[model samples]
Target: MTADRQAVTQVLSGLAEIRPWYQDLYRHLHANPELSMAEYATAERIATELRNTPGADDAEITTGIGNTGVTAVLRNGDEPCVLIRADMDALPVREATGLGYASTATGTSPDGSSVPVMHACGHDSHVTCQLAAYRLLAAHRDTWSGTLIALFQPAEEAFDGAQTMADDNLADRIPKPDVALAQHVLPGAAGTVMISPGPIMAACDDMFITVHGKGGHGSAPHETVDPVVLTAAIVMRLQTIVSREVDPNDVAVITVGRMEAGTKNNIIPDTAEIELTVRTYDERVRTRTLDAIHRVVRAEALASGAPEPEIRFLSRLPLTTNDPAVTEQVRQAFTAHFGEDRTRPKEREAGSEDFGIIPDLFGTPYCYWCFGAHDPAGWYAAEAAGTAGSDFPDCHSPYFAPLLDALDTGVEAMVVAALAWLGTDRA
Candidate 1:
């Protein structure tokens, strides 16, 4: 191995020493997950851990950046600065993983509803991996010299946590990084890395639509202009936007995930509510798709002789495009560390993320990659049988839980990637 590779391997060897502490930390986080912008306890716990870690004692830690976000800065000497990010918020999904540490925690959602909160997206693993990586790097300062920023962000599920930090003068708070890096837990085999050059994830928009109508007794159908019927018609018509309107060559998705109407069977409600999401890869396609949705919704309401429908957008996430040069650097590092079989080119994902917002604010190049944390045997079996999609629980699912071994994989991947920029060659 070369000098830099040898240094990275020596640093990673410390993983065996720190593994137990981080595993316990992951369990604690998984059990006591908090909602978006409400991660007060989570932020405090992370800060406390940083203060208590031996080599990280000299680090300067800051809390409450954008509310419930935490940052720990470790500056060893004059070297390239690298910002490593991990989201801290949990989703409003109830846990069903049946693990001993499964979350029974609850939190108030954005809509002020009491919902079950779980780390169904492997954010618990994200935080654990980042913390372990920081600990390893801090302890082995002699191996690599540079400034490292570990950012624990909040409200990623709401898709605005990064933006919230930027709005709160994040540029004034932390050191501007030469490069920003982030990673997510995917549902593939554990310890493997997945990466691509550009547009790895899609841009997404969430919309809330309400159609107004006349309420009446269930027995008096003629007196009521039913909004439930109007909403159903609108949903059906909205499907045509992708098929009949958008080009088949391009990709776009319009999904009406939720609809709320009357509570009682005997009464017709005055209004019907629809919560839908739009996903697209291209800006022009996104604009056109959104325009088509507006036209269809209004036209359907008019055809149903209902009042003008109310439409509001929320939780807009930008396309996660990887910087080509930055991505190639990280890809090389991953291949060297994880070997050829474990490091493979990734296909573009339809999922959306707000990570791009942070690097964009500073105008720095950034690369976001995914690491698998699933059972390797099971994942491969499912893939062989063409049952991967149905067998493996996805990020938002209640049953989604990464294997324990993923902690080692994530920490090593992060350390290797960070060392790519903060290597001894630069020192």
Candidate 2:
């Protein structure tokens, strides 16, 4: 075996011993989730865990970054520095997995409404794996030499955590890393890794639109402009943008996730609201798509003799493009450690991430990868039966549940990837 592979194996030798602790941690986190930017208790728990770790006594721990983010830096020598990130926020999804440890927690959402919160996106697994990886690296310090920065970020579900960290002077607060690394638990065969060189995830843009109209009784629709009809027309026209305006070769998705209008059946509402999300891979395509939306909304309103609709941006996320050199190093390490069968190339995903913001802030290169947490048997069965889409529950779903076997895989993936930059010295 190569020196790097040997080093990785040595560092992970104690994984079996530490597995139980992290698995329990996963359950605890899974049952009690915190919403975006409100992860106060979660942040404290992470700091406490790092402090109590065997060899992490000297690690510098920082808390309350970006409201509720945490970072622990463990240094073995004056070698390369690698920053590994994991988000700690949960979504406003109620638990439906029916697991004994399923979340029954509730938190106030950004909209000031009480909503059930759950780790529907597998972030609980992300945190557990990261903590386990950090503990292993610390316990087996002789196997590698470098500064390892374990960052637990907050508010990722709101798509602003990375930016929030940067705005709070994350670079000045911690040692700048030569490269950044992050991983996500996805729906695939357990113990497998998914990686790509560039643009693994798309850019996201959300907009809230309000269409104005004159309100009147429902029975007298002829006397006033009907915003419901105008909005319907706008929605239909928006569909044509992808089919007619954008090139069929490029990828772009426009989803109208929310619409609000009249409250009573007998009264026509004065205005209608629409909230949509736009996903795109290319900057030009994003711009073109957004411009088309503005034009279409205005044109449809004008055609209906209604007032121009007001459009406001809800959130924006840049495309996640992995550095080729960084990705190759991690990919080779994964192949060497996990073997060819488990280390596989991943296709471009339409989902969006804000991780790019942090590396961009540090002006350094980075790579983010995914690992399978779904049951291998079930995933393969779905694939074989051509029912993968219908059979497998994806991230952000209340029913989304990652198998426990993936916890070890996630730790191994992070350690292997971090060691690619940290060191290859024998223990």
Candidate 3:
């Protein structure tokens, strides 16, 4: 075996002892999920666990930096520092997995409605993996020669945690990371690790369009300007942005997620509104898509004799671009540790991660990998066998649940990646 591979194996072997603890923690967090910007208790629990772990006394916990986020520093050597991030916030999804540790925890949302909260997105497993990495790195500090910064971030579900932490100077507080790494649990072929070189996640932008027309009785067809009709026309035309305008090879998606209009059946409403989400990988394509949407909405409204439509673009999650050189380095490390067969090329994912925001501020190398969580014998047998949960719950579904057993490989992979980047002791 190669030196790095052997070293990684040694660290992974050491991690085996904590496998049960990782599962227990995963269950606890899964049973008590918290929402974005409301991860206070979650943060405290994580801090407490880290503080109690061996060699983690030097770990410094800073709370409330980015709303409800937690930042911990684990120092070992005097060499260059690296940052490893794991999101800690859960989704507002109701638990339907029917597991013993399923979340019964409920909270009043910003709208004041009670909703079941669960770690359906696998943040619990993410937390466990990060902690496992922290412990392994800390225990074997003698084998590595650099500082490791662990981020227990909140609000990743809403794509705001990384920005929140960055706004609070979390990056500046520590030595600007030489490399930034994170892992996402995916329900896919078991024991496979996937990575893409650049623009793994698309840029996500929310859109709102309002169409206005004169209100009149339904019977007076000629007297009333119909905005609902205009809105419908615009929606259909918006599809052309991707079909006709953008290159077929360049992926772009424009989806109208919602629409609202007149309430009464007998009258034409004065206004109608449409909500849309636009996703794209290339900047030029994104700009063209947005322009096409605006043009379609305005022209359709004008052609239908309606007032100028109002267009609003809300929160934008920038396209996540991984540095090529850094990505190659990670690929090489994964090949060294997991073998070339286990580490394969991954296609670009349509989803967006707020972690993309990190590269905007610093030049540090940043990449995220997919951690296998699917169980072959279905949920029951997988749970009974203590295998990793499948990607089945889907990301934002109410039934989202992750298999905690898969996190063992996640932790080991992260440690290997960190050590490889730091140029620590070769396997």
TM-score of each: 0.87, 0.90, 0.90
- Model 1 off-target regions past 4 Å? 108-115, 210-234, 258-273, 298-310
Q: Give the Cα-based TM-score of candidate 3 against the true structure.
A: 0.90
lDDT per residue for candidate 2 within 1-427, as digits (tens), equals 7778888888899999988899999999999999989888888989999899998899999998889989999988866999999999899999999999999999998779999999999999999999999998998888888899999999888899999999999989988889999999998889899999988899999999999998999999998899999999989899999999999899899999988899999888899999999999999999999999999999999999998889999999998989999999999999988999999898889989998998889888999999997888888898799987688899999999998898889999998998889876655
Each prediction's Cα lDDT score?
0.90, 0.92, 0.79
What is the per-residue lDDT of model 1 for residues 145-199, given as tens digits with 9 covering 90 to 100? 8799999999898888999999999898888889999999988899899988888
Steric clashes per prediction: 0, 0, 6
Q: In model 2, where do residues sit more than 4 Å from their true spots?
A: 110-114, 213-230, 261-270, 299-308, 425-427
Please give, for residues 76-112, the per-residue lDDT of candidate 3 as tens digits.
6656777888898887777788888988898768898
What are the per-model C-alpha RMSD values against the true structure? 3.3, 2.7, 3.7
Model 3: residues with Cα > 4 Å off, grouped in runs: 1-3, 6-10, 77-79, 221-224, 376-393, 397-400, 425-427
